[model samples]
Target: MAGLLQRVKSKMAIFAHRKARGMLDGEYGSVFKGRSLDFDDLRGYVPGDEVRDIDWKATARHGSPLIRRYAAVRRQTVLLVTDTGRNMAAEARSGEAKKDIAVLALGVLGYLAHRHGDLVGLVCGDSTATRSLPAKGGEAHLERLLGHVDSHTSLDAAASRIQEQLEYTARTIKGRHLLFVVADEIAADDAMAQLLRRLRAQHEILWLTVRDADLAPYPLTGQVPSAEVDYCSVADSALLPWQPAASAAVKAAYTRATAERDAARRAMLRAAGITEGEVAGSGDVITGLFALLERHRRAG
Candidate 1:
């Protein structure tokens, strides 16, 4: 028993160190406080059920003892929509990839939401969309979300699935929910808007641009250097096998084009009343997320 207790202690210490549990008991209003006890349902009053467990509503009707049951308070519903496209799977760290970053962020969010009595769900998209179980309160739900997230593969199959998922999301969910998207840079500035309108009609939306810095900045590496950078790949992928000078020019031109795309992306986000999240080189993913939630709460 002592050894078991020590193991438990060690596990808790490790979990606490991860900042997930730290934030749980942290000074913030994150720990979901209990709500006023209310009716849940009624069953037979057990020995420990306070006399108050008696449900007058059923008791009076049935002329028998019906213990009142009160379930835990309902928490917020926070949904994470992860892009499982090839873009999102790019490796940033030698060992950890962009998909790893996304999943880690989702884990953190799920843990925090669990503490706040919030229901957490995850939707991963490629060309198709894959979703975990619907949001419900509990650590089990978090585990389930992670399990589903881990099961996802970023191959081309997701393409068709994502479209179908988007179509399905519009039909099933009917009320406001907090929806977050973790995706690579978008091609269309208005892409997010269309997604929001179709897939997340009733939810408040936020988009987290998960990227590897290399995608934006091509570094001079190796004696031969990176394959001739073709600026037109994003615009037109047909131009290839250019001369070294052409590659240099392509790289320069891409620098400018990417900047323009970013500007357009942000402008579109603002127009749609959505918040943007950034996570870059050796970057701390939680920095912007904390601020996003705080600001959102204040707005609410």
Candidate 2:
């Protein structure tokens, strides 16, 4: 696990340098503050001003719309809410385990936070149990947290109850935090969307999905060999036998259903005002994460 963490860290080091460049140039918000802004000054409202930034009192006093500007705070908090469900152990098209990709993704963020002298914490769990580490600064502390994530998150665990983790974070974590939710290709059901909305009210939310092979569009032909797949619940598990021969119609229907689910998930995230990115299990996770952060940085 230590070796794996080192490899991830090494791969992410380059991206981290890029992040530093953004900070120095003030092009990308610095890691310490990133998107976190503190009230700085006020100005006349521009045509494109965000409504939320409008100062109603100032507008009334000045007889015109005015907007408040803010400066990025010097320090911030980052919390990683990771899913350790059994499905996360599934292999991706890249033939790498989703859990490893998840770890790498978390590592990149953790390293960045550590470098910026910010607090980094973790909320990791599966269906059975969830563990949390309070936000703290230091490389040693980050290392321990990563080790814990690697040890506790497993593919053999029961189905993931991600809502439990989300609720836990909402209840326990206070103050504004940059929340990174790492999970599988689970559709954002209504309950999950509600939870995310609640979290977004106080925290900046970033969702990173580890893509699953099951959701990948594949060429479906006649007489495809398949195996039994088990779908587990808290109360019980059900194993469905795979069809020995699937018709083109069946394949098309499955693909359509998966696509719809994916689209719905994107919509849910958008509704909750969350930015999201996806990394293939076998792809370069560091690069994917850098891209995600780059987007966030530019937006911020």
Candidate 3:
């Protein structure tokens, strides 16, 4: 079967290409607009009316003053860091795997960032950090970012590496923007915590993690190819031939490893004060963006 990245890349292109309309959430993307005035009800005031919105003629007739209220301005820059490590490909968590979910999540986030008029960029890597796209705005630029995320691959899965990447990201970004780190697992606790403390101090940071169901205890679809395989999940890389006789045991071990990684991720995020969104194999892009937007509002 084709990998999850390939599948989601084909699917999300359609959603991102569509022209956004009405509210941002309407297009299944996050919307960022400037300090546009929000209409609030008019109310009579005894003081602080600066002689504005006070129907002078009506006030003259009623002998009173009134004013209107508006919501605060909206201003933010966004930087997205995507971790495409081997941990994502582990068969432990969900049957669908983590890499697939992470890719789709990035596509959705890119769409929303474009809607809000915020510059969008991506940092994709594995054992060693790879591509770096500077945050920029425009339909074409976002398309390039989407294309970039489509090609990423990683070698490692430690969350501690996040701090190193974040520092580099901070140096390159040059501005306080909302930071989104999309990864499947968060096992490197101490590293993640330090990164979060510093990142949140300078910018609003959010972690978007896609979780699979299989790791939480589920039946396995037993099938082991009786042939040499490209094994990508081993800590110290080694290739081995698959044997159908032990497929069941292999599946069990896979399940346990994935479960441990998932638990580690949840615990690490909780300790770091980072929130998580579960991205399923068939998660909704629009729904997730709306929830994220609501969270941003609450924070504001």
Query: What TM-score would candidate 3 get against the native?
Result: 0.61
Task: Report the C-alpha lDDT of model 2 over 147-262, residue by residue, as the tens digit.
Answer: 88777766567777778899999998877888888887777688988988999888887789887665222343334334444333222345433451144676678778878988
Comparing 1 and 3 on TM-score, the stronger one: 1
Candidate 1 per-residue lDDT, tens place, 1-300, comes to 333223323443565677744553342243224422334677876677656447778888988789866556555577777766555555553325666667666766666656666677776656644554677877666666665655564433333223334445566665556676666566543554576555433666667776544433323442333565443332223453434323667677866887887888777666666777766622355555566555544443
lDDT of 3 by residue, 1-300 (tens): 654434544555554556322333443232234322343565677665535345566556666675554455453556778765565555424456565566667755665567666667777666566558887877677667655654554344532234546667756666466678876545656766676676666666677766544422323445544344443333556553344325567767977887787788777665655656655564454455556556654444
Candidate 3 deviant stretches above 4 angstroms: 1-75, 85-100, 154-161, 212-219, 222-234, 239-264, 282-300
Clash statistics: count for each candidate: 10, 0, 9
Candidate 2 colliding pairs = none
Ranking by TM-score: 2, 1, 3
What's the lDDT for all of these models? 0.56, 0.72, 0.57
The candidate with the higher TM-score, 1 or 2, is 2
TM-score of each: 0.63, 0.78, 0.61
Report how far off residue 293 is in candidate 1 (Å). 2.3
Highest-lDDT candidate? 2
**What is the TM-score of candidate 1?**
0.63
Model 2 regions more than 4 Å off:
13-65, 69-73, 215-246
lDDT of prediction 2 = 0.72
Please give me the total number of clashing residue pairs in predicted model 1: 10
